[model samples]
Target chain A: MSVYPISSPPSPQAVMDTSFWSLCCYCGLEPYLWKVWARPIWVPTVVKNQIFYHAGDYPDQQAFQQAEHEGLLAIRDPQIRITQFRSGEREVLSLAQEVSATALIDDFSAHRYAGTILGLDTVGVLEFLVSLLEAEIITLAQAESAYHQLVQLRATNQGWLKWAYNQIKQRGGNP
Target chain B: MATHPQLPLTPEEVAELHRLIAWTGLEEPEALHKLVEAGLAALRLEAALHLYATAPLSTGEIAEQTGIPRGQLIRTIQERRVAPYEDPTIDQPALYRDLDERLKRRVARWKGQA
Candidate 1:
């Protein structure tokens, strides 16, 4: 718990969805994200519910609990029309769209919706990991470990993810 | 420098075997044995990847379906590099770079650092 940031970045505040939070926490990057992103990432209140109730990642739950007094995970409702997506995804897109901030999402459908439908800047957990590496927030070994855990957590067969992993492995964690 | 074990066969079965041998003009069964072995390996590889690609099953589940051991399946996957994550977004690193300026603005902020 006594992790010191290798460096800091101006991480433009982004609206986060539940899966993104859960995945980051699941892969041991939650506190690092909290320490590195500088700006408090926004999340809908329902996203809070999703994290506390639905998320199976204990680290994510614990991270949220520890972050309570820090005000890094800002909770707000993006009051909007509901869609076929879950409240968390809908609200993240809504909030990001309303404020024109990037949406931090990892679910494939929600990720696509953020970029293609909402026309907002979107970043997935992988890109965020790369950003952390580029900013010197985490070392390459940490990135490699985090990514391997992420790939296992996702349990996906998508090849591009492998390609991206290879790309990151090929590059140094330099900004 | 090889040995041939005698196969238990009835006269009719032997006749049928000879007929097939004559039909194919084959002297030994080594080729058929190897072909079947190679086919099974191909089937297993295909089944494993197909099971992985079609569902979100863990490597254990895929191994269960394909009858491959979990560790073996993982070793094979790592060696071959299959079933990557589903998104193609990482192809564009420039898009991710645009936001770096915003994130790189401040120095390390976590407390209790050396």
Candidate 2:
């Protein structure tokens, strides 16, 4: 007899777990509709520099640890890009050979520094979230709830969530 | 018998007189004298109400019709001192229905054309 049956009896304990259970149920019910992995491009150096500068009052130890936890730093392969510039020219002469993903950043100075100086594609998180919401992978209610949670998290971490929320709210969502 | 010679009314003066008569409903000498001073203020409100009832007009159009400064009109509308016409896209037939119902109530009380 096969250990993994085609239709197995459902476990009651599995239903109560919101995180893994929801994902499992969604996958089991709609196997064709599941998105297993997101191929998100992470610009580690850019993220690390921004976090280090902007992470106020948090100890260097804690900030470094948090950055690792948040997957802001690349663990396995450290991809470093070196660029050379000529005198009196505003642009960089050369760029890195390999770039998997671009960083989404909010800080104006960091954005300008990365975009103009390093030639990286920097997008805002709220704009990205709006696009995700519009794509229907995430419902509007879910997006709103997640945004509220993110606001609280940002307030705890960065201390300007209220201003950020107000700005984003003023720019109406896609109808 | 009239003591003074009548002067022809300009288009603006005629329109202003019509608005004043619509608002005051008075033609007596005492009322006319009172209206000559307060007529513009009363007509200004009537003009606003007409605009509000009919459709949403631009600030420039409202200013041109009522002689109220656009800034003042905007401030009044924003502060809810005067209600503006609702946008057709957002409100649809419900806005017109509500306005019509309110006008009916006011006309019933006044026993006159609204």
Candidate 3:
């Protein structure tokens, strides 16, 4: 028997990944809430990637520094050689040797790498969220609500929404 | 070796031996041997003792309820003595009377110091 009844499924175009960027676009608005609520208890490899991705776009210097101090900026890709180019300085710090770079951008490269070049594993996020729901810290209904809100806020991707919906159902949500 | 003469049993003696063996009532040869060896008898005695200790019945009441022959009941009681108590009226007396006595002695020693 399910603990609670499932609400209507999330909108068809709710993108889970895009929600992070939406929050990033409005970084100074209220970064603390996402940091507290959304961030998993023990930072997984994927969550660490998301944190680094969010931190890379912050306009404020303090916010960027806060992210670094909180160990959000330490996660790195295994494949890439990250080098920091200091303005007007000949000494280029090889970030791979010093510590793994959280965010790396090359002008010539087609893709900007923030977080591990390995890409964020959404499975970990899904598992973490499902655990949170099972623990009753967040309800299945609340997750569905959040998903719909994210979709309305221009989050797009049917696959992510369906995946999340299935996860909730698997955890014994009555549809 | 010296040849020994075999003495014949009287009919009464043979009948008495048969009667004593017949009390076992076990059909199987193995069961009869076990009964003669007092294995099942010992287990039954232990179970009876446990019931006597835990059951809400006096020794006399248990003897009456079980219908164990009075002589056997007296012998069993003698073999398995009831735990000592300050007063016999108390129900389910503690298993360790000696330990309670030791504790009382320790308390007395401490009280003397104080």
Candidate 4:
């Protein structure tokens, strides 16, 4: 219910959703996203719980654990209580508010809540990819490849994916 | 060796996909995106029990206030015979049988590993 403004970007510490991390892992772009955009990313305790639940089963589990061990990603509990969103989204949004960090969320409703209601500068998977493209951290070919990977994973809604592709193209990315 | 998986679509298919993307309009209605604003489903049940005990409200009234379907409220209250303080939501018994079966299998696997 609390609103924050997106005009002045928050600190570079990224509070991300589990889905975004999973998508990055699927495309082998997790490290790239962290290094280029997140800049010492953090996960909410609930997100960490999801990671653990997927640890032995998911391909990205080791990367997440390794990131935590290396201090590139830290998992902390959200100070505020929120129940309207799913476990991961709720924790990430609260943590972002608690720390005044940028929110990198992908779920549509949760994304809207953070960006529109909370006034946090929010980034989605597409925006993160576009950032990589603009920064020249990822080649156009890599971006295209990652997009296909996302499609295969169905990590995002199909309609949103199409919209995101158009956004990327508008930004002069060759995708 | 291939460094990555092959592109799933052919060039023609990819262009067709681009065309499809263009055809599809963005901006879905906000109403379609709405979810319950607050309260975990489990906590809602717990709160309903507390209210029933404290307020002496009828079961139907509690169901209406809590947004729980009336029939489900009846079953939860009568069939489960849930105590006011006991947490019935600890196990998701209302989940689909298939999911419950799978979770049981997973817990069994973990138990065996231990």
All DockQ scores: 0.06, 0.01, 0.00, 0.02
Judging by lDDT against the true structure, name the best candidate: 1
Candidate 2, residues A1-175: lDDT per residue as tens digits?
A: 3211223221111000011111212222112111211221222332233223333553432434543454332322233334331110111111112333333333223333544676554333333333334434456555565566444323111212333344346445322
Would you list the rank order by TM-score, best first? 1, 4, 2, 3
Per-residue accuracy of model 4 over B1-114 as CA lDDT, tens digit each: 111133343565444333322322212221112112232355455455555444434433465566554334433443344322222342323322322243344334323432
- Report, for every candidate in turn, its global Cα lDDT versus the true structure: 0.58, 0.35, 0.32, 0.55
Worst 10 residues of 1 chain A by lDDT: A155-164
Model 2 stretches with alpha carbons more than 4 Å out: A1-97, A153-175, B1-114
The TM-scores, one per candidate, come to: 0.56, 0.27, 0.25, 0.54
Largest DockQ belongs to which candidate? 1
By TM-score, is 1 or 2 better? Answer: 1
**Of the pair 3 and 4, which is ahead by DockQ?**
4
Task: Looking at model 4, give its docking quality level.
Answer: incorrect
lDDT of 1 by residue, A1-175 (tens): 4342424544456788766776677677776665544456787886777566533546667777666546676887775644635456667788887777778776555665566677777767776776667656678888888888767654333442544475575675321
For candidate 1, write residues B1-114 as lDDT tens digits.
Answer: 122244444565454444433433445474234224564345455456555544444443455555655434443454354553344444445433433433343223222231
Write model 3 residue lDDT over A37-121, tens digit each, in one string.
Answer: 3221122233233334333443333443454465332332233333322110001112222332111111111011222242311
* Residue-level lDDT tens digits of model 2 in B28-49: 3533454455665655754554
Clashes (N, CA, C under 3 Å) per candidate: 12, 1, 0, 2
Higher-DockQ candidate among 2 and 4?
4
Stretches of candidate 4 off by over 4 Å are A1-11, A37-39, A55-57, A167-175, B1-114
In model 2, the Cα lDDT at residue A19 comes to 13
